[model samples]
Target: MYTMNRTATTEMEVTSIRLERDLKDRLKDLAGNQGYQALIRDVLWNYVQQKSGDYQPQLSPEEIRASVEATAQTEERCVLTGKLIRPQERMLLGLTKSGEMVPLSVESLAR
Candidate 1:
């Protein structure tokens, strides 16, 4: 007979995780009856909470605009292919170094 852990009762999708044998054993021991999935979830949740608490405020609109203008004036590259893209060049087609046509955003080019 096979039974799933308690999280299966929720609408969340099921996923598999692969861990080293020793690490798995340690987590299972720490998890006790809760199962390794619950323990891993708790560990990930704590990490996210701790990390998200350190966020900084966004730049002001004027500062953002200035930065974008400065970046646009400077040499820019395609984000995906990292090839140099000139300011006057037709942005959409001329950018891809790999020759794959990808969407290029004006805001992205400014940065």
Candidate 2:
């Protein structure tokens, strides 16, 4: 049996924070340099979220597992050998005979 943590459902969490006056000024300048007139919490949050798996889309373990399984089952077969591929879900491929994988954009293939 398994249960989901209620707090883990969101990408954003709130807590009281303190900033030194000079640091606050620097942050505000950084925000303004980006063309926003005021500091946005999301921007700071994004900095904190880098590579922490805290800013990913919401998908439960079962759903993710199911998606992976489905992708495996429907892998685009390599035209050369008829072997199943770990499909590049967003792009087409050109399998060179030298066993090198080349990515081809849909637009280029359509032309």
Candidate 3:
């Protein structure tokens, strides 16, 4: 999930490595069906970017969704009204009269 900040916005990466003949064939076979090179570049760049960022955990969509859902359930216990908020939405709003409000996505927010 490492996307480049490029203008055109197509995933791109450059690499210098060697693949064995058999592996190359396998890749070619896969390429015909699945853009193998495109995938390889994306995966390789993901590793590179992740490492560059100190190995942040790459959470899947399901994980994020589940986390958000859990937070929403907990938040529901507190009040019956007020729009459900997402973590990103709260972050975008910043702090109110208090200070920096803890950022939470409606699915993930606890309160």
What alpha-carbon RMSD in Å does predicted model 2 have with respect to the real structure? 15.8
lDDT of 2: 0.39
Candidate 3, residues 1-111, lDDT tens digits: the string is 344443332543456778888987877786676466655666677667544643333332222222212232232111111234433232212232333233233433333
- In candidate 2, which residue pairs get closer than 3 Å at backbone N, Cα or C atoms, i.e. clash? none
lDDT accuracy of residue 96 in candidate 3: 26
Position 70, candidate 2: lDDT: 23
The global Cα lDDT (0 to 1) of model 1 is 0.47
**After superposing candidate 2, which stretches have Cα over 4 Å from the reference?**
1-15, 33-40, 54-111
Ranking by TM-score: 1, 3, 2
Regions of candidate 3 where Cα sits further than 4 Å from its true position: 1-17, 29-34, 54-111
Per-candidate count of clashing residue pairs (backbone under 3 Å)? 0, 0, 8
Where is model 1 poorest over a 10-residue stretch in terms of lDDT?
58-67
Number of the candidate with higher lDDT, 1 or 3: 1
Model 1: per-residue Cα lDDT over 1-111, one tens digit each: 012244554677778888999999999998899788778876776455335552222122222211122223334444333445466543432223333333232444343
| Sort by lDDT, top down from the best | 1, 3, 2
**Two-way lDDT contest, 2 vs 3, winner:** 3
| Model 2 lDDT per residue over 1-111, tens place | 111232332564566578787887787777666432224454555445433434332222222111111223234432323333455445445544444443333333331
Cα lDDT listed for each candidate: 0.47, 0.39, 0.41
Q: How do the predictions measure up, each by TM-score? A: 0.39, 0.25, 0.33
